[model samples]
Target: MPIELPFDDEEASTDVDLKTQIIRFILTGAGSAVLDFGLTMLLQYGVGVSGGIAKACGFVLGTTVAYLINRRWTFRAEPSTARFIAVVALYAVTFGVNVGLYSWLSHLWSETVIYSALAFVVAQGVATVINFVVQRAVIFKIR
Candidate 1:
């Protein structure tokens, strides 16, 4: 006798390796960070927004990019309000974590630009890990 899947076998590959998925998310996020930092600087320099305000604007932009990428490309989640809310809540948690650490670590580096870059890396890195956990356990879990 042969085993039968509950769903049709025509579905996309379900065995995407966890490690690969995380790496893909990171790479996508890295691309998004460029937009984040670039927009932050443009707002700060050209528009003269304060650091905190500029960071907030950039974060929103970057997070939008991340959400679209993660949902459509990385996780390929089915559309649902509960899943969307979970992603937002998870990001909100990571947002505070990212901002706090970025502010603290920005002081560690000499050049402000360099400091900002490193802060983005560190904060985004932490957020990425948290996203993986949340996405795997809650957000993207098939139920």
Candidate 2:
């Protein structure tokens, strides 16, 4: 017996398969993470900014990058005000989740780079799941 995929030939040809979208999303996420982490570290260590503020700044910049790449490359969606609004709403929710979780977790651990990075990872992981699910199922769902 052979395993069957959800999409058929025509759909696979015309639409991006789930696997491809996921791969692209991961790649996009990696790039975004680099920017986010870099900025956070730079602000917190280099500029002497507070952890919470640095995290917020990093998250905003990274999220903006992720949204742009995910919209055009990952999901292959056209630009729309409605989609933009939906994304903004989604980001707002994730922003709180990501930053709040990081702040809380960072406080728990010693004020070291390793500990801070760990907190950031935990928060980013949670937010990434929420973002992928909502974006794939709702914001960029295929008609």
Worst-scoring 10-residue span by lDDT in model 2: 5-14
Off by over 4 Å in 2: 1-14
lDDT of 2 by residue, 55-103 (tens): 9999999999898878777877766678788999999999999999989
TM-score of every candidate? 0.78, 0.88
Candidate 2 matches the true fold with a TM-score of 0.88
Residues 1-143 of candidate 1: C-alpha lDDT, one tens digit per residue? 22222333344333567786788688878888888888877876668876566767787889878777766556655556777788789888877877667667766665366677777678778877887788877788753
Model 1 global lDDT (CA atoms, 0 to 1): 0.72
RMSD of each: 7.3, 8.1
